[model samples]
Target: MKHPKVINLVQEPEVFYRIQNKYDRIISVLGGSMQVGQVVNSDIDLIDITRRGLPKSVVITVSLILGISMEKMSSLLHVSHRTIQRKGDDELLNVYSTEQILEIAEVISRGIEVLGTLENFTKWLHSDVRALNYSKPLDYLDTSFGTKLVKDILGRIEHGVYS
Candidate 1:
């Protein structure tokens, strides 16, 4: 008998908060928030370390660092807007069909280098030194949570995980 496929619930608030916790932890250990002056340097450092070239993952990193929309990055990369949207959608939705998983696996296997030392992963959770400085009230947390999730994902990548 075929078992029912387990549906992954995309509960935005809870999911975002969890991502935020992970991201904040990384930044805390890293000393401070990454600044504009440091973005270029950090990007190059990560690129050299990963040596996997840029893929959908880079788009997310670039977005967080530059505070730009995914659409703009998609245009620059010459990848379709839908593809960009799909990546973010999948991330937020936390849904990975067999086909998408296969695609991700194929991409990473192409140049599987370091899988991120545990130490590196810890560095990403710290507070932002070159912070975005986006203010938010404590009462309204969902927005902050989403930002945290994005930051956390970046931290994971810094640790060299494909996520």
Candidate 2:
């Protein structure tokens, strides 16, 4: 069997620490393995982490990963800013929000795989692309349909297409 790719968090301390904090917050609410700074073997690991429901801190982490603001994240999740705030750290997101978070995580993992770095992927997401009708890929992340469009573009880019 082929071994899964391992992302060594120790090598990327900043991103590692950010994810560590998020993991800590998640475990605080949902209770899970408390190990920190471990490798993300695959997208499956991420999906497993949120199998129940994600903590609100995940929104902050995703915001950091995508370089978007909390307000934009609220828009993407189709929730009000105050609603997000009211949920607090211990509250779990609804099923739809959890699914969206998982989908975004999958995209983030794939983007990193294709672009070779999180910074490169974030730049690609924020840049306007002709294939996407000259709109920044980040703009399409506000809804499920838009997320699918961004994922399709990422798939094309992965396959060496000029998307």
Considering every candidate listed, which one attains the maximal TM-score? 2
Stretches > 4 Å off in candidate 1:
1-55, 88-163
lDDT of each: 0.31, 0.65
Writing each residue's lDDT as its tens digit, candidate 2 over 1-163 gives: 5533233332342343234233322222222233312233455655655566677866776777778888898988889988998887757787678778766755666666577777788899989998888999888876678778888888898899997
User: What's the true lDDT of residue 25 in model 2?
Assistant: 26
**TM-score to true structure, per model:** 0.23, 0.71
Give one digit per residue, the lDDT tens place, for model 1 in 87-131.
642232112222222222222211111223222322332223223
